[model samples]
Target chain A: MSGPKPNELIEKIDYNPPQKGWMDVPVKIRKGMYCYASNPKSVEYVHLPHARPWNPLEEDWKLPDNWKEIVHNAFRERLDRFRSFKVFMDICVRCGACADKCHFFIGTGDPKNMPVLRAELLRSVYRNDFTTAGKILGKVAGARELTLDVLKEWWYYFFQCTECRRCSVFCPYGIDTAEITIMAREIFNLLGLNIDWIATPVANCYRTGNHLGIQPHAFKEMIEFFVDDIEEKTGVKVEPSFNKKGADILFVTPSGDVFADPGTYTAMGYLMLFHYLKEQGLNVTWSTYASEGGNFGFFTSHEMMKRLNSKMYAEAKRLGVKWILGGECGHMWRVINQYMDTMNGPADFLEEPISPITGTKFTNAKSTKMVHLSEFTADLIYHNKLKLDKSRNDNLIVTYHDSCNPARGMGLFDEPRYVINSVCNHFHDMPRNTIREQTFCCGSGSGLNAGEDTELRLCGGLPRANAVKHVHEKFGVNMLATICAIDRAALPPLMDYWVPGVGVTGLTEMVANALIMPGEAERTTNLRGEPLPGMEE
Target chain B: MRLDELLTQKKTAIIDKWFDVVADTYPADTAGFIKRQKDPFANPVGGTTQKSLTVLMDELLGEMNHDKIDSFLDPIIRIRAVQDFTPSRAISFVFSLKKIIRNQLNKSDFNDHRILAELFEFDLKIDLIGLTAFDIYMKCREKIYQIKANEEKNRTFSAFERAGLIKELPGSGPELA
Candidate 1:
C-alpha cells in the first residue's frame, strides 16, 4: 500500500519510523538471516527450564501453549528482581541519541540495530503485558499481545545486540541497553529458546570447566603446544604452572587464548610474561577448573553468570593464592569489574594484588583483588623493571582498539596503551569517536561468534573494521593491538576481510616481541611466525 | 557520431544524478551525514563514492576495460555485498548510467547512423560491466558464506575432535607427547 517493497530498489527512507506500532511491520527472516536452533544436548546439559524442539525459520516453533503467559510472568519477575531492568523498561524518552551509535546499525543500515529501536523491540512487549495504558489501548499505546512473531523478533534483535553497552554511554538517562538485552535473553532462556553458540558453551563451561570443552589433559596440552611454539619463536622454553597449590598469584584468561589462532599468540605472551615473573621467583598458578575468563553465561542470564563466576574465587581460595591476574579479555573485564564481587566475590581470604616484583599495590583493584594483565605490565614498565626494546617493533605501525567491555564497562583505557607505547615505538589512534569510551564491538561478541551467524557478526563488525581501515590508510598502521581475547580471535579475520595487510595482536604479544629477554634468540619474526619486516635472517 | 562524447560532456550532471541514487540507498539522515562528510573515517560509505563514480565516468569515456571497471567496482560492490542490500539492489548503480546517457542524448543525435552504432557499442559495454559486477557480487556473497562455514566448523571443533570425526597428523603435538 505504501512505498517500495522491502526488497525493492532504493528510494527515500523514513528514518523516523512510527513509534507506537512495530507489529504493523512484518518480520524479515530471510535465508542465511537467522541461526539454527539450539542442539537438544546443549539445552539439556544446562537443564534449562523449558526443553522442547524448535527452529527459528520453521513455520511452527512448537511453543508451549502458555508461552505468552510464561513471557509475561518472566518479565514481571525480572522487573521485580532488578531495579535497573525496571528503570530501562520504564524510562526511554526515545530521543534518538543512540540511533546511530550501534556498529550493527552503522554497518547494515538496519533500523532494528539502532540501540533505541532494538530496546523498543522489548519495550513494546513490556507495554503490551504489564502496563495498564498498554492494556487499554492496543497498538496506539505501542502495545501488542506477545505473539509468536513478537517472540521471534525479540530473539533475533536481542541476540543481535552484543550487549556491548555502547548505547549506555551516549544515553542521557544512562539507560543501559545491555540491561534490557540480558533480561530479554534471560527470559528467552526461561522458555528454553537458547542458541547453540550460547547454550553449548554454557553447558561446556558448567561441566568441563571451559567453554571449548577441552578436558583437563587437553587444556594442559593445548598450552604446552603454545609453549613449544613460543620456544620456536623466541628460543625461550617456558614451564607454566597448572593448578599449583600455595602459589602467590592465580593466572586466569579466556580459554580462547588457549584454543584459537592469534589468541594463542597472546596466550604465549602471558606465558613469556609469567615465565619472566617465575624466574624472578614469583609463583603464579594456572587452574584448569577455573580455565575460562570470558563468560558465555553472562550472555545467557545473571544466575548462570553467578554460577560460572563462582569458580574463580573458589579455585583461588582452594589454591591458597594471594590474588588473581586476569589476562586479555573484554566481557571478562566487565564481569570482573562490575559484577564479579557482588555476584560471587568477597575474597577476604586473599590479600590485595600487589605486583610481587614492582611492590606496587593495585589500590584501585583493592576490593576484588584482581589485577588486569596490562595494568601489571604497565606498573613493571613504569618502574623500568623489564628490559623493553621498542625498536623490535619498527616494522609495525600499530593502533589500539579499545574493546567495548574494558573501555566502557571498566574504564581501562590508558593501562593497555601505556604498555603498548612502552614496547612499540610507532602507535596511532583510530579516531576520537571510535576509540576509548566510544569503542565499537567486534560484532561477534557474546555468543554471536558462532559460524552459523557469521554474516550478522560481519555486519556488526563493519564500523570497527572501517575505523581500522582509515588508520591503516592514513597512518600506515599495519598492526591492531587490543586488550580483549575476543578481539584477538575475532579482529584478525575482520582485518583480513575489511582491510587486508592489517595484523591483530594483544598488547602483551607486542610486548613479548619487544622484550629483550635474557638468553633468547635473535628476533626475526613476531609470535605468529610471520617474518618481521626490515629484519632478514 | 561519438557516443562516449555525450556521457563525457555531461559527466558532472550524470555523476550528480548517479550520486542521488547511491545516496538513496542509505537513510535520509545518513544521506545528510554523507553529504556533509569530509573525513573518510567519520563517513566511509560516503567517502568511497566520489572516487568510485569518477572512475566509472572515465571508463565510459575511454575503453571500457574489465580491469579498469573492476578496480573501481570491486571495493564498493564488496562493501555492499555485506550490507543490507540484496544482490540486485547493490549493483543497480551500474544500470543507472544508461538512464543518464539516454536522457542526455537527443532524438536527432540518435538518428545519425554513426551515433546510433556508437550508442549500441556503449550500451553493450554498460551491460558487460553490469555482468562483471554481478560476478563480483556473487563471489563476495560466496566469500561471506565461506567464512561462515569455516567459523561454524571451528565453533564445535573440540566436540568433533572428541567424537573422533576430525583427523589429525598424529605427530601434530610431538612436544605434548
Candidate 2:
C-alpha cells in the first residue's frame, strides 16, 4: 500500500515528450477528446459516400479500398474549384504567427491544435500529392506520404478546429485556416467520416428544414407554447403567423432557440419583440418550411451548405417577403455573409431589406437581402420605436461575447453592443483582447458542441471563461450575453464549469426583459422567472 | 532561523519553482510557451497556475484557511483535471512542493531540532493540501460527467416534450409519469 519514493513519482510523471520531429510523432486519439463517429444512417440519408459503420478509436476505419484515391481526387477537384483553397494550401510560410492564437491550442496545449499545425496536417498531404519537390525529396522536403495513420491524424486534428478564423486575423498573409478545415471536412464527408454532431444535423436539416427535425405542426406548437408563456408573464397575448404570404419580413432562427433551454427564452424574447413591433404596424411572418437560420450543412460540406441554405431564398420567394431577418446564431451568419450570395444567389427575387420602423435602407445587405437581428433591433432602438425600461435588466451586469461568425466573418461588432447598451443599464466588456473581432470562441462552434466531448469543449472554453472570470471579479458581471443561439446553448455549461455564478442570455432576451409593452403586467421576475434586482424580497 | 522564517524569506522563489513544476506536466513546447507568456488572458493555463501557486504558498505558510486554500487549489486542479493527465499525475503537482521545499532547505543550514519539527509539521500540511487537491480534482471530473449527463437529458427532455410523451412543460412541477 506504500506509495513510490519522491524521485520515483517524479520520474513516472514525465510528461515532457521526447524530442522527436513533428512527422515522427504519432497521433494519440484520447477518449473524451474526440466525438463518436457519424451514424451511418445519417450519412446515407444525405447520400454521402462510404456510409458504413466506422469508429475513430479503432484501428480499422473501414475506409474504402481506394480511400487514398478518393482523397486525392477530391483534393484536386477542390483545388480547381476554389482559388482560395489553392492559395491557402500554397501560401503558409510557417512564420508561427498563428501558433498560439487558436483557443484549442491555448487551452489544451496540444501542438496539433495550433492553427499552423492543424493546417499543416492537410498541407503536408497537399504537398506530397501535388508538389514536385515533396514527391522527390519526401520527408526532407517537409512532406510525408498519406498513409492510414496520416489520414487518422487529419481526422483527429481537423475536427478539433471550430473554424472561428481567429488565426486568420493574425496571419500576415491573411491565410484563412478555416477554409483549410472546411476542405478537410469536405473530404471527410466524402469518406463518410463526419461526426454525428454535424452529420445528423445536416441530414435532419436536409429532410425537415431544421436541425431538430421538428415537423410543421410541432414547430408551430413550440412557438405557441412560448406565446402562452409570454401571455402569462406579460398579460399581453401575441399572435405569430407561420408561412403567411406577403409579409414584409420573414423571420428565421436556429431551432435550438425553440427546443433548448435558455435558447427557448431567447425565442420568447423574439416573440415579445415581434409582438410589440406588430402593434406598431410592422408585419413579420415565421416560416415552418425555412424554419432554421443556423446551418449545420456549413459544417458538413460546401454543397450541403448550399443545399440547406437554398431553403431561405426559396421560402422568401414563396412567401414574397421583402427581406429576411435572421435570428441569433453563429455559423448561420457566416454562411449568409460569405457563401450564401455566391452559392445560392443572386437572390434577385427578394427586395432589399429596408426597416419600415425607421425607413433606413440596409444597403449593406443589398446583395443577399437578409438583415441581421442586431442591426434590425439597433436601428429600431436608435429611432426610439420601442419604449425600453433599462431597470428591468438592472439585475444583470452584462458583457457581450461576440459570436465568432458574426464578429470575424461579418465585422458585426458595434450593432449588438449598441443594442445591449440601450437595453441594459450595467454593461461591461471583458478584457479588450477578448471582445469584438478578437473574441474567443465559446468552444462549441462549427458543430463541436456534442455532449461526449465535454472535456474538449471545457478546455477550449478556458480562455473565454478566463476573460469572463476577470470581469466577474472586477465588475461583478453576472450575465454573459450573446447573439448566437449556439452561444446561448453552449455558454451556460461553459460558465457553469469555468466561472460559476455567471449566467448566459441572448441580447434579445435582455431587450425583451426591458421592453415596456402598452398593456403588460407589472413585471416581478425576468424571463427565467428569477426575481428582479429589488423584487427578491 | 526557524524553518517558518526561512521559508517566508524564500516564499517567492518556492512559488516560482512550484509553478514551473506544474507547467512541466504539459508537453515541452507547451511548457515553454506557458512559461514565456505572462498575459493572463492570452495564456490562461500559465496565468492561473502562477496566480494560484502564489496564493497557495502564502496560505500554506500562513493561517491555512480551508476556504482560501480550496479556492486557490480549485482553479489549478480544475484545469489539470480536464487535461490529458492520469489521476495520479493530475494531483502530483501538490507533492512536488515538498521536493522544492527540501531543495530550498538543503541550500540553507537548517539542521536545528526545532526546525526539523517545524519541517515535519509543514510536511503534514503539504499532505493535507495534496488530499484537498485530490478532492477538488474528483469534484471537477464528476462535474464534467454530470454536465455530459445533463446535456443528454436536456436533449431527450426536449424530444420527449415534442413527441407528446411529457405532458408538463418546464418551470411546472415534476411530471406525473
**Each candidate's lDDT (Cα)?**
0.81, 0.89
Candidate 2 has a TM-score of 0.97
Once model 1 is optimally superposed onto the true structure by TM-score, how far is the C-alpha of residue A191 displaced, in angstroms? 1.0
Residue B95 displacement in candidate 2 (angstroms): 1.1
Over 4 Å off in model 2, which ranges?
A: A1-15, B107-114, B169-177
lDDT of 1 by residue, A302-367 (tens): 988989888888999999999999999888888989998888877788898888998998997888
**Per-residue alpha-carbon lDDT of candidate 2 for residues A1-537, written as tens digits (9 for 90 to 100):** 798986796567654557766788899998888888999999999999889888898999998899999999999999999999999989889998999889999989888888998898888888889999899988777888899999999998888899999999999999999999999999999998999999888888889889878888999988998888888788889899999999999999999998887888899999999999986778999999898888988988888999999998899999999999999988999999999888999799888889988899999999999999999999999999989999989888988899999999999999999999999889999998888889999998999989988889998999999999999999999999998988888899899999899999988899999999889988888888888778898
Off by over 4 Å in 1: A1-22, A532-537, B1-13, B26-39, B62-68, B100-122, B152-177
Model 2, chain B only, scores a TM-score of 0.92
Model 2, residue B150: displacement in angstroms? 1.0
For residue A307, what is the lDDT in candidate 1? 90
Give the clashing residue pairs of candidate 2, or none.
Answer: none
